[model samples]
Target: MFPTPIARTSSGTQIAYKIALPVALVLWLLPLIAVALTSVRSAGDITAGNYWGWPTSFNLLANYTAIFENTPIGKYILNSFKVTIPTVIGSVALSCMTGFALAVYKFRANLIVFFMFVAGNFVPFQILMVPVRDLTLNMGIYNTTAGLALFHIAFQTGFCTLFMRNFIKAMPFELIEAARVEGVSEIKIFWYVVLPLMKPAIAALSVLIFTFIWNDYFWATVLTQGADTQPITAGLYSLNGQWVAAWHLVSAGSIVAALPPVLMFFLMQRHFIAGLTLGAVK
Candidate 1:
């Protein structure tokens, strides 16, 4: 029989820790739980000052349907998808190539180029906001999903490149050398060898980028004006203005807006963690 390893904490300490854990979790999730509960509550319940009480009835489906039917919530969600999917694909694809070049090739300017990307990624978005908005206007993609997506793709590329470069650097260089010894062309080596091993990195970046783009209210508002092109984040702000005291509907909309990225996180959890933990092992 195997003996269990006993934790040697004082009883008082264990009691304190046990008390603290639930408190901390409640604190962390309080807002989300509140919103969720609010989403199912009746508008009369809110008016009757029953904000935190048991819901009079579970009106989640009703609230969600009202949000879609009464306003352009569906359009906003569609816009979010339009912007998010392209940005994720474009940024990841561009970064993979850029990262491979920086990691594999030796050039006089390699470090300089990599540092520039790193610096750009860390810069405040406000610094680039004015210029990016102006550029989008000039390109005539402003007030459109394309404009927002283009900016996201360009800005996210800086961070994605850094991630990809570091990930590729941690890979075994011997594989590349062995392939080269067999006279495998550079393109074939990248397509067949490097890309296959990059699955974890790709998965990680895809989820991260999707969440970032989906949650982006600032760029969405700045680049796109009307409901026709505005994503859910920005649309939520506008809906908040129109809904006024309709807290139930507002809460429902917010949850609906937040669901896609949350679903993506759960669905790709393994790859996401693998990507984040890359280069942790020496």
Candidate 2:
């Protein structure tokens, strides 16, 4: 059985929960608060070693403006979009088809294939970095947005497939059977019946993949070298001077780079919630 609801908990426990809530919230938000403060601090403050202290001057607008005016962050953001959007579409589309097949089809190798997908997710990505980088170089796409996107699509497909397979499996098989009984073609069944039902999952997965790819720094640094192909995560380093670290500007740029995903989640909040909770209640 599930644990008792907080509302029904003992008075002492309720008091403890009430006291712990704000403390936990502050702890979670402390890093973000520090970054926000740092973003508005003037460069002099950083040089004076005034980090985590009151800023001598607030340069909110100047710092934000300087990132675009002085750095290639704008181009990096565009590159991220170019890479992330395609990867999301490709991974989600492929996962849908693969998930549908694995969930619906009966074959001796079906479980084996699904297990393989699951197993791939367990492998440490760091271990494959060398080979993956070499492969990209061999394919003549090294240091390009296309190369990064291709790798992302391949790596993300397994998790997406796993997500989609379970979601599809949870769907009623009777619907598929009914479509077949009506003499509907298999392709038509997937297109007309299953695809519509998959909208929620698709929306949720898109948001997840978009965030993952957009915020990816490790691969961004490992695969691409400069602003020409770097995503915002890696490109932020361009703000650093040879002798100075512009922490304020870097913080501002981070806030800027984080906006798209935050907006994406908020805009799709309803759909994302529905997708996640679709099978939870019943």
Considering summed lDDT, which 10 consecutive residues are worst modelled in model 2?
A: 236-245
For model 2, how does the per-residue alpha-carbon lDDT over 1-282 read when each residue is reduced to its tens digit? 367788898999999999999999989999988899999999999988898988888999999998888888899899999999999999999999999999988999999999998899778889989999999999999999999999999989988888899999999999999999999999998999999999889999998889889999889988998888999888876555421577898788889898998998899887666655645886
lDDT of all the models against the reference?
A: 0.92, 0.89
- Candidate that would win on lDDT: 1
Q: Could you give candidate 1's per-residue lDDT for residues 1-282 as a string of tens digits?
A: 234222466777778878998999999999999999999988899899888888988988888899999999999999999999999999999999999999999999999999999999999889988999899999999999988999999999999999999989989999999999999999999999899999888989999899989999999878998889999999999999999999999999999998998999899998777666666877
Model 1 earns a TM-score of: 0.92
Per-residue lDDT of 127 in model 2: 94
Model 1 sits at a Cα RMSD from the real structure of 3.2
The number of residue pairs in model 1 that clash at the backbone is: 0
Cα lDDT, model 1, residue 98 = 97
lDDT of 1: 0.92
